[model samples]
Target: MTRTATIIGGGVIGGGWAARFLLNGWNVQVFDPDPQAERKINAVLSNARLALPALSDVPMPVEGKLSFHDTIFDAVQGSEYVQESVSERIELKKKVYAQLQQANPGVLIGSSTSGFKASDLQEGSPAPENIIVAHPFNPVYLLPLSEVSGSPRNTTETVERTAQIMRDIGMYPLVIRKEIDAFIGNRFLEAVWREALWMLKDGIATTSEIDEAIRMGFGLRWGQMGLFETYRVAGGEAGMRHFMAQFGPALKWPWTKLMDVPEFNDELVDLVANQSDAQSGAYGIRELERIRDQNLVGFLRALKERNWGAGKVLRDHDAARAAVFHAQTDTAPKAEPLTMAHMQVLPGWIDYNGHMTESRYYFANSETVDAFLRLIGAGMDYVAGGHSYYSAETHIRHLGEAKLGDRLVGTIQIISADEKRFRSFVRIMKGDEVVATVEQLCLHVDMAAGKTVAASPEVWANLKAIAEGHAGLALPEGAGRAVGQKK
Candidate 1:
């Protein structure tokens, strides 16, 4: 419907959110105070320019325009949703929300703060009921998750409605049951980070070891399934109760500490940096990003065929995207072919240089003939049944340029036909002017013999009847040119 999404920041995350909405057909207006906002946005847009086009399942509508605004109020005037992604400070968010509310009371507002409660930011607002917290991770366009949490003071329906919009734009919207700082996903990450940091502080494992532990071992199991679901599977025949009875003691081991904040100092920083460099071998940020994208593409594509987990979501999204172009799934069947089913020129029939390649004209005429063959009882079904007509020789004469947008029609008249060999004269016309002509001799191919073979009895009868109807017509000048030219 050409909905308007107003973004109040142009940082990495904000720009990603912009790409998601814009790529899905929303007109976006951006309000950023940073002097380098446009530069940063351009960097994000460049990535999106390649990515969105490559994975798009169908033709996208025209690219959405991005407008820059000097102030949040000016930007939110007609916006459907005002995404406030300014500085993480509570005061800054409150100020932005105030500006948004003052501009438009009906507009829904979202803050991009990771751990801030909506109430803290919405307290001093006139329309606190419409403001919610929506925290998305880095590379927002690629990652599907959005931790959509909101305070009770906000309208619950509004938050739910906003989540639906997020889904429409291809996001995984997880609603926060309780308005808590550092919602579900980050809380899980924080728990793992705390334990990993403990190992580094004690010199028990290197940074590489911790990452390898996750990537190679249980990490993969929990990747497509959450910890609980994975454990449920592990329980196997005995299920959760029996499995927990046998292995729950490990949860209390001295090696695992639930609480320990490692002090951030030079030694700790160097420990992390050295271990990281050792693990990945000093890859640049861009290279790492490219690797991440390739891996995600591979993972997502594999998941699409099985229609499992996040892959199913991706599959559904692609289907929805395809609906734009493939709405004619049940359209009527194509027409039967006449005279070897000659076809006219399509848009890409020729190159930008404005001359049809000699090879392509023959192919186009052959396609038309193939369609007519289908009408005469030889089609893809016949080929699948181990029979086909293969062209052995052809002669073509190009009289003029087959320029772009030219509508050319082709006609094929059978000169002779038998079980072993058949000949046809193909002529191309632009209006009444003859652009080209082809005289092709084709062999009835036998798949098993890998050689010319006689046509089947049924095929011979059909061809004989069709040939007899046009027996009185004179052959074109180009006809019978194999042995000698008619001229």
Candidate 2:
């Protein structure tokens, strides 16, 4: 079933969330009071057009309906989920909720408030259970850090459901078990900020120096493993207990005022802002933000593959989204991945021309086979060294055409195997239906003198075996067509 999410405010975070969900295939209804709502949303759509379609690990899930609404109620009229990202004021939030409750009573309501406790935010609501803090970090599409909190009874379900939704849309949702002012992460940052201010005031360190301390040292560790996990590694072979035994004594040392809070005043605010302006003035806000997003995407994708917590979430989300895409599109099941060599197409490969592009089809088939050869240790170097190459000598008659919306596959089967030469017959099929047959002759060439030559002993032997096994494939029916052709 297609999901409809009503986005209440089409500002930066909301726009980003819009992009994320829209990319993951959710239809969105956007409502923002600002007269510039269309321009704001279209800007986000422009980014999503480039960003979402590029994540082609799977045919990206169904894109949601993105329509601008005159009022919040219109946006929420039939939404499964409602994400409110209007201005963050207690009174403003209450008004939004009251308006939202009047629109739809049971649909989940997520506030984009970063710091407000759910208790305070949901107070006096007709159904406070429905509203929860789904506080997302800035550039929500990229950072993926979100803190979700609500009243004890409903918060867990709300968090779990929202997190699942976030995962589907490729966001990291961190649930706060208990709500506190600003929640756990920012509260911790608040503590550090209070102390860091004193250092700035005292001229103990430059702004860059404090930031460098974290970025160069601890921040690298923070991306993969959280502070606690990294500290456990520091404990040595004995782990956290042994490390605590050694370093617990350092608690007595007078390290800086990590516990004290500094006074916040005009002078301090100006001092910090000036320092920030100095640090960042080399680039505009837009450029700086783009650089940050690209870096975060790289780090997040890397960590995700290692099955670290955040990475695990990303991987699971990826798989889930892929399944959703396949199901929605009714894409046919692909052949088992090419452990040896194969080419299979899901429905999305079909083009508007009613046939797959010739170049893309070739590219897809070659990559599938390349992946197989790579697993057996014959990759770029194996061919580039000019020792082994497959030359398409002849492509026979097309048995049938693969239509625009058909699931098709192709396979290359070896016909003959020799140390110096090899032959293969290729078949393109639409399910059980054969569409085309290709026959190719290959040679081991040593381009040292631009001449055909034998490959390395080990490589030739490995190739000979795989080739011999596939040589028995019933010679692709049109094999004789190219036999009498001139060079």
Candidate 3:
């Protein structure tokens, strides 16, 4: 059954929530008085469609329906969940919640308030348990963290439900143990923001310089290892304790003006704004958003490759979806090729020629073959058990070029197989056109002995069945072709 979510306030964060839900197959009902809400959301969705799918190894779900409504009642009609991203006024939020609860009393409502605690939002509410903090970072469609903070009134079940909804939408929910203002992420950001303001006032650095200080240095470490872990690594051989002992006395130093407040004045505002404009005003907001999205996709993908931090959440999401895909193929093996993997041509896959690089073509083939290996019960687990298939000889034929932003499908056909060895063919397809082909000979191996070995009976049974199904099919075109040979 398809689920529905209602988004109140179609601004940046709200539009991001809408895209996140809609792309994850939740029908979205939006209620925003702004006449430009649809346009803004569409713009956000356009960026989302380009960026989110690149993070997935399996194909993303078909997008759900999106509808706009004039009234909160009309919007919250059948929505099981509601994400409120209105202006950060306590009264405005309370009014929105009243209207939402009146329409759907039992619906779970998550607020995207950066500072307001769940208790504060819950004040004077009839259904306090239903309202919780689900603050997401900007570009909500890409970043996975959703700080889920709740008040004492919110039961464990409510918190769990909210967290599960976040996970379902490919978000990492860090549930705050206690209700705190600004939650976790924003509180840390608030400190950094204060320091940045002071630096501008003192002429310490320009906006561009502060940004570079982050992106060029610790920001990379913070992205992957986070604050404490990064500091722990800085501790070196003795670890965090030793490092803390060394730096503990520095806390008394007058290095930071975190406790001091800079006067709020027009001069400071112009000083920051003028410098920021000079730094990045060249690109339009949408253009800059696209650039940021592309860079994040690359960084997140690297983390996903290693199954670390936010990448693990992505991998877990893929695994959940892959379970469904694998279940569909659990029946009899088909006579024709099996479609095993779906991929997008990510930004990093292209070369100077603006086409996919040679190595990426091979990476595409590996993705297909790897999925096939998992299907036949010879995946990572089998390798972990000291027996696996190792590619011995391989031939690749590039029939056509694949460029950036193109969607590709990978299909595999079994050519021949036995208990000891098997030969397979893979095609990397762009729609109906074959962009490339890979044929490989593989041998089952005993890792400890480093020698070729016979296949396990269970694995062989699955592989042999697939091979037999493809026995009647003709050989794929260009199969076994040598380099420089005629087509």
lDDT (Cα, tens digit) per residue for candidate 1, span 62-149? 4677888897777776788877788778887887777777788878988888788888878888878888888888777766778888
Per-residue lDDT tens digits for candidate 3, residues 334-397, read 8999997777676567899979999998898898888889888999999999998899999999
lDDT of 2 by residue, 127-235 (tens): 8888888888777666667787777646467668877776667777778877788887788888778778888988887678889998899989987888789989999
Q: What is the lDDT of residue 325 in candidate 1?
A: 33
Better of 1 and 3 by lDDT: 3
Candidate 2, pairs of clashing residues: 25-62, 26-64, 27-64, 27-65, 28-65, 304-311
Q: Rank the candidates by TM-score, best first.
A: 3, 2, 1
Looking at candidate 1, the ten consecutive residues that score lowest on lDDT are 328-337
Model 1: pairs clashing at backbone N, Cα or C within 3 Å: 340-369, 341-368, 419-454, 419-455
TM-score of 2: 0.70
Best-performing candidate as measured by lDDT: 3
Which scores higher on lDDT, 1 or 2? 1
| Residue 462 miss distance in model 1 (angstroms) | 24
Which residue pairs collide, candidate 3?
A: none
* Cα-based RMSD of candidate 1: 9.0
Distance from true location, Cα of 356 in model 2, Å: 14
C-alpha lDDT of candidate 1 relative to the true structure: 0.73
Model 1, stretches more than 4 Å misplaced? 52-56, 277-281, 327-487
